[model samples]
Target chain A: MKILVCISKTPDTTAKIAFTDNNTKFDTNGVQWIINPYDEWYSLVRAIELKEADASTVIHLITVGIADAEPVIRKALALGGDEAIRVNTENSDAYYIAGQIAEIAKHGQYDLIFTGKETIDYNGSSIGGMIAEFLNIPYVALATKFELNASKAIITREIEGGEEICEVELPVVVSCQKGVAEQRIPNMRGIMAARTKPLKVTEPVAFESLTSIISFELPHAKAGVKLIPADQPEELARLLHEEAKAF
Target chain B: MPVLIFIDTAEGHVKKASLEAICYGAKIAEQLNTAAEGIVLSEVKDDLASLGKYGVTKIHHVNSVALNHLDAQVYIKVIAQIAETTRAKIIVFSNNADGKAIAPGLSVRLKAGLVSGAVTLPDTSKGFTLKKTVFSGKAFANVSVNTDKKIIALNPNAYKIETRDGVAEMIPFQAAVDDGKVKVTKVTKASGEIPLTEAEIVVSGGRGLKGPENWGMIEDLAKSLHAALACSRPVADAHWRPHNEHVGQTGIAIAPNLYIAIGISGAIQHLAGVNRSKTIVVINKDPEAPFFKAADYGIVGDAFEVVPKFTEAIKKLKGIA
Candidate 1:
C-alpha cells in the first residue's frame, strides 16, 4: 500500500510559549522545536509498522515548511518513512497547507493517506479532513486502531459512552490518535540510513495565499490561590457559596 | 436539497448530540432560507416526528439493523448518496466522534468546502465564512467555504439547542445499504455512574490528594455536586484511577461547563484538553502553583482538609446533608 503521511514541525512541548513584537507572532527565540508529537508518535510510527509488515510498502512523509524544517523532516524519514518531501515554504495556513497536500496527494495518488489528528503547534484537527475534502476521499479521524485488507480498511475509534468501528474502502484519509502505536526511537542504523535516504525538495504549486496571522496572545491569567484550612470543611463551603458563588 | 442532519441514536433512542445537531442544522437552514431535513440511521425508539420541536420538517428514515452501528466509510457513502439524491447544498454534523469521522469523508466524497469544530453560525454577509476555535481555544479563525458544496461540523456544547412547537413529518427515503467489512468484536465498556465526556460538572484530582487512600475526598465532593470524577495523567499512570478517567492533552479532551481541579499543578498538556471549559475551580495547598493562573476560582488548601468541608457545605446548602 502506498501511504502518505503529512507532518509538521512544532515547538517542543516544554518550550515556554511566548509572543514576539508586542504579541504578534509566536516567539521562536530560545525555543527548541521538534517534530509535532502527534506526527512523530502516531503517524510516523504507524507508517513504519506497515512498512515492517510489508517490505514493498512505501510510506512517504511530506511537510510544508521553510528550509529550517528539513532536520525535523529528515528525523521523520529516519524514524520510518521510506522517503521525504519538503514543500519549501512558510505558507502554513490550514487552507494553503491543505492545498499543498492536496496537490501532492492528487498528483501522486497514494492508496492510503495518514495524519496525526492535529499538530501540537496549530492544534487544528481540520487539515486532514480538509485534504480529504480537497481530494474527495473518505476520511476517518482519531482512529485508534486500523486493519487494512484487500480493498477495505477497518478503523476503530473512541466515542462518547462507547466506541465506534468503521470500515472504508481503499484510498482513504485517516487521522490517527494516541495509542494507535507505541512511540519508537530511531536506532543508529536507521539514523544512518536516513542521512542517505532520498530527500526530495519540491516547490509547492502556486495556490491562494494565506490569511495573515493577525496576532497571538496568552490566555487571561486566573486568580491567585485562596487557601482554606484543610481541616475547616465549614470554611471551605462558606467560601464556595459566599465568595466564589460556585455553589 | 437543503441541509441534511445525521440524527444519531442508540437502541432507537435519540442522543443528546443529535438534538444539538438538529438545532444547529435547522438554524443554518433558516440562515440559508432552506428547509431542514434529517436522516435517521436505524430503528430509533423515539418517534421521528417528535424531533420537529427542533424545527426539522422532515425525518428521512431507513429503518435497518445494519446501521444501528457506525461505519465512517459506509456512513460517508450513504450520506453522500442521500445528499446527492436530495441535492443538499450544505451538510452539518455534530463534530462529535461520528461527525469527526464522517464529515471529512463526506467532504472528500462531495468535494465540499469543509470546516470542523465550528462554534457559531456562518457569517453570510460575503461568501460563507465559519468561525472555529484554534490554539486550544485561545484563538478563533474565520474560514471561508469556497466550494460549491459546503460541509460543517459543529462542536457540542458550543451551540445552544432551540426547541419550538412543531411536529416533524416522517418521510421514508430508499437508500442503498451496504454491509461493510467492519464488525464489532467485544466492547469493553467503562461501567461508571457518569461518563466523563457527557458530564456537565467534573471534579478532578491529582497528586495533591497525596495517595489513593485519600481519593475518597474527591469522590465525596464529586458525588455531592453530582459531578463526574476525573484524574490527571499521573494519577492514571500510577493506577490510582482507571485510564478512562484521565483528562488531558494526551487523554480525553473535555469542555465541561464547570471543572473543579484539586491538587493538580496545571501541566500544559492537561490544560490543552480542558482549557475550553467555561468555569475552572482549582483547590490546592500551594498558592504559587501554576494551576492557579488558569483557575477562575482558587482555594489554597490541602485537598484532604478542604474537600470534605467543601462537600459538607454544598450538601448543607442543597439540604441534602
Candidate 2:
C-alpha cells in the first residue's frame, strides 16, 4: 500500500512567541523550528508503523514551504519517510497550501493519505478534508486509532461528548492527533541513510491566496497579581465574588 | 442561500455554540443587507422558533432520524444541495468539533473560500476581510476570501450571543440521505463531569500535585466551584489522568471564562492553549512560578493545604456546606 503523509514545520513548543516589524510578523530571530508534533508523533509515526509491519508499504512525506523548510523535511525523512516532496512556496494560506497538495494527490494516485489534525502554529484543521473533497474521496479528522484490514480501515475519532468508531475503504484521508502512535526519534543509521534519500522539489500552482496578514499584535498583559493569604481562604472567596466576579 | 447558519444539536437540543453562530450570521446578514436563516439537519427536539431571538428569521428543518448522527460525507452533500438551491453567498458555523469536520468538506464541494477560527466579524467595507487568530492565538491575521461563496467557522467563545424580540418561521427542508461508509461501534466518554470546551470555569492541576492519589482536593475544588477539571500535559502523559482531561498546546485548547491553576507550572505550551481565557488564577508554592505573570490572582501556598481550604471557602460561599 502507498501512503502519503502531510508534514508541516512549526515553532518549537517552548519557543518564546514574539512579533517584529512593529508587531507585523512573527519574530524568528532566535526561534527554533520542529516538525509539528501531531504530524510527527501520530500521522507520520503510525504510517511508518504500518510499513514496518508490512515491508511493501511505502510512506512518502510532503510539505508546503520554501527552501528554509528543507531541514524540517529532512528530519521527517530521517525518522522513516522513504522520500520527501517540498512544494516550493513561501505562501502560508491554508487554502492555497491545500490546493497544492490536492493537485499532487490527484496525479499521484495514492492509496491512502495522512495529515495532522491541525498545525500547532495556525491551528487550522481544514486541509485534510479539503484534499479529500478535491479528490472526491472519504475524509476523517482527529483520528486517535486506526487499523487496516485488507482494503478497509477501522478508525476512531474524538467527538464533542464521546468517541466515534468508523470504517472507510482504501484511498481515504485521515487527520491524526495523539493516541494514534508514539513519537519516534531517528537513529544514527536512519539519519545517515536519509542524507542520500530522494527529496523532490515542485513548483506551486498558479493560485491566489484567500487571506492576508494585516498585522500581528501580542495579547494584553495581565495586571499585577493580587495574592490572598492561604489562611484567609474565605477572604479570597469574597474577593472573587466582589472583585473578580468569577463565581 | 441568504446568510445561512448551521445549527448543531445533540440529545434533542441546540448547543450553546450554535447560538453564537446564529448571532454572528445575523450580524453578517445585517452588514450584507440580507436575511439570516438557519439549517438544521438532525432531529432537534428543541423549539426551533425560539432561535429567532438570536437573529435567525427562518429555520430550514430536516427532520430525519438518520440525520441525527454526524456524518461528514452526508452532511457535506446535503449542505451543498441547500447552498446551491438557495444560492447562499456565505455560510456560518461554530468552529467546534463538528464544524471543524464538516466546514472544510463543504468548502471544497462548493468551491468556496473558508476561514476557520474567525475571531471577529468580517470587515466588508473593504472587499470581505476577516481578522482571525493565528500562531495559536499568539497573533492575528486578516484573511480575504477571493471566492464568490464563503464559509466562516467562528471560534467557540469568541463571539457573544444576543437576544432580540422576534419569532422564526420553521420550514421543512427535503434532503436526500446517504448511508455513510463509516460505521460507529462504540463511544467512550471522558470521565470528567463537565467538558472543558463548554465549561465556563476550569480548575486544573499539574505535576505539583504529586500523584493520582492526591487529586482529591483538585476534584473537590472543581466540584465546589462547578468548574471542569483539567490537568497539564505532563500529568496526562504520565497516566495520572485521562488524556481527555489534558489541556495544553498538543492537547485540547479551551477558552473558558475563568481558569484556575493549582500547582501547575505554566509552561509556554500550556499557556498557548489557555491564554485566551477571560481570567486566570494561579496557586503554587513556588513564588517565582511563571504562571503568576499571566494570572490575575496568585497565591504562594502548598497545594495540599491551599486546595482544601479553597474548596471549603467556595462551598461556604455557594451555601453548599
Q: Which candidate leads in lDDT?
A: 2
**Chain A: TM-score in each model:** 0.94, 0.96
TM-score of 1: 0.85
lDDT of 1 at A24: 60
Instruction: List interface RMSDs for the candidates, in order.
Output: 3.7, 1.6
**Whole-structure CA lDDT of model 1:** 0.78
The CAPRI class of candidate 1 is acceptable
Residue-level lDDT of model 1, residues A48-103, one tens digit each, is 89888889899899999889998898888878888898888885566678889889
Q: How much DockQ does model 2 earn?
A: 0.67
Model 1, position B291, has a per-residue lDDT of 82
Least lDDT summed over 10 consecutive residues: which range in candidate 1 chain A? A209-218
Q: How much is A91 displaced in model 1, in angstroms? A: 4.4
Q: Which candidate is the best by DockQ?
A: 2
- lDDT tens digits by residue: candidate 1, B149-248: 8887887777777899999999887788876544555444455556676677899999877788988878888988888889998898788886667887
Off by over 4 Å in 2: none
TM-scores for the candidates: 0.85, 0.96
RMSD to the native, candidate 1?
3.8
